[model samples]
Target: MIRGMRGAITIEKDEPQIIWDETVKLVQAIVAENNVQPDDIASIIISTTPDITSAFPARSVRMLEGWEYVPVMCMHEMNVADALPLCVRVMIHVETTLSQRDITHVYLNDAVKLRPDLITKNV
Candidate 1:
């Protein structure tokens, strides 16, 4: 079955290095929490808040060894009023046997406030 895992992380600033580092950290946590292997990933979609224009989050994913074959895309998140700033969010689709209820969603740093219910149960 194809499953989707969601994750998000907040960066302290809009610098390229900080964006790259935070993106990698967020993806790493998602992979670890979901036991996701590169081969099993179908595609990864990343979005950042409008303030995060220093770098593309997908660039960080491609930097990971063995992730070259994985499909990844990055875009700007909708600039909604009161939305979290410097936030990067990702949705990873993968082929897995885990049921929806068993799948884990990760929200780290200040992004954890985005899903308090899930944090208490899954993160």
Candidate 2:
């Protein structure tokens, strides 16, 4: 079955290196928590808040040792007036046996605020 795993992370600044680092960290954490392999991933959709324009987060994932062929896309998150800033969010669609409720979602740093209720039970 195809399941979508969600994760997000907040960065202190919009520097390219920092975006790459945090994006990689967030993706890795989510993949590990859900026991997902590169081959299981069908696609990755990544989005950054409007304030972050330094780099494409998908580059970091594509550069992973075994992720060269993983389909990935990058874009800016919906620019809501009061939404969190400098945050990167990802949705990873993967082939998994786990049910939706069994899949763990990862939220790091300030991004944890995005899903407080879910985090308490799922993170």
Candidate 3:
């Protein structure tokens, strides 16, 4: 079976390193939570807010994890008024045997506030 897990996190600063570091943290948490092994990750799609154009957060994440073969993509988030800025959102398609209810999702930084109920349940 395959499962889709979703995660979103916000960077406190617009700087490249800060955003990259936080992105790494978020991905690590998400993968661990969902019990996704390196070979289990089918692909990852990441998007960042328009305000963040310095670098693809996914690049930093892949480098940190040393995952060279995982398919990764980074794009600009849909520009909208009042949307979260400096945010990195990810949707992971993973090959797993776990049921959907067992899947874990992650939200970090200000994103934790976006869905406090969910984060509280996981944390």
Candidate 4:
């Protein structure tokens, strides 16, 4: 089955290094939590808040070893009043036997506030 794993992380500033570092951190966490390999990932869609224009998260993801062939895209999240800024979010489509309820969705740093209800009971 193809499952979508969601994750998000917040950066302290809109710097290229910070964006890349945090994006890598978020992806690593997602991969570790789910035991997914590069070949298992179908595609990754990354979105950053409008305030974050310093870098493209896709650049960071594609640079990961063995992820060069994985399809990935990056875009800016819709800007909403009072919405979280400096945030990077991702939806990774992967081939997995794990049920939807068992899939872990990671939210790190201040982004954890974005999904307070995503805690998986099976973990």
Candidate 5:
């Protein structure tokens, strides 16, 4: 079955290095939590808030070992009046045996406010 894992993270600043670091951290957590390899990922779609224009989050994912082969796209999030800032969100589609409910969705840092129910404190 094709399953998707969702994750979001908030960065401290709009700097390229910070965005890169946070993106790497978020993707790594999503991959580990889902127990899926990069090859298992069919595609990954990443979006950043309007304020985050310093870098494309997908670039960080491509930097990961073995992730270069994965198809990934980056986009800008729709601007909302009260939306979170410096937030990067990703949806990774993968071929997996896990059900939708069983998939772990991660929200880190200030982005945790975006999904209170799915946020895992320990992660």
Candidate 6:
């Protein structure tokens, strides 16, 4: 069976290292919370806001976790009015035995504001 975990986080700053660190931390939490293994991950699609084109967030994550074999792609989010800036989002598809409700989606730091209801639901 297949399951998915979605996570979003905002960079504390526009710097590459800050984005890298935060994304790494958020991905780690998703893996831990959902008990996701590297092999279980089928693919991960990451998107970042337009204001953040300094680097592809997925590259940092891949390097940080040594996910040389995992498939990851990065893209730019659609430009919309009054949208959040300096944000990175991820959708991870994984092979899992758990039910849909068993999966946990995470939104951390300033990103929590994007889905306050989701955070509350998970909590």
Please report, in order, the local distance difference test score of every candidate based on alpha carbons: 0.91, 0.93, 0.82, 0.93, 0.92, 0.84
Q: Rank the candidates by lDDT, best first.
A: 2, 4, 5, 1, 6, 3
- Across 23-115, the per-residue lDDT of candidate 5 in tens digits comes to 999999998998999889999999999999878888988988899999999999999999998999999999999998889998999998999
Better of 2 and 3 by lDDT: 2
Regions of model 5 farther than 4 Å from truth: none
Instruction: Report clash pairs, candidate 2.
Output: none
For lDDT, the strongest prediction is: 2
Error of 4 at 21 (Å): 0.5
Assess the local accuracy of residue 118 in candidate 6 as a C-alpha lDDT between 0 and 100. 67
Best by TM-score: 5
Residue lDDT tens for model 3, 38-120: 78888989999899877778887678555778888898888999987789998888998888778778998778766665664
Q: Residues 11-120, candidate 6, lDDT per residue (tens digit)? A: 86678888788888888888888888899999999998889877778877689555878899999999999898889999999999988877788998788888786674
Please count the clashing residue pairs in each candidate, in the order shown. 0, 0, 0, 0, 0, 0
Model 6, position 70, has a per-residue lDDT of 86
Tens-digit lDDT track of model 2 for 1-123: 999999999999999999999999999999999899999999999999999998999999999999999999999988999898999999999999999989899999998899986685544
Off by over 4 Å in 4: 120-123
lDDT per residue (tens digit) for residues 5-123 in model 1: 99999999999999999889989888898898999999999999999887888998998999998999999989899999889999999999999988889999999999887884544
RMSD per candidate (Å) reads 1.2, 1.3, 1.6, 1.9, 0.8, 1.8
Q: Each model's TM-score, in the order given?
A: 0.96, 0.96, 0.90, 0.96, 0.97, 0.91
Give me the runs in candidate 2 sitting further than 4 Å from their true place: 121-123
In candidate 4, residue 99 scores what lDDT? 98
Q: Could you tell me how far off, in angstroms, the CA of residue 97 lies in candidate 6 after the best superposition?
A: 1.3
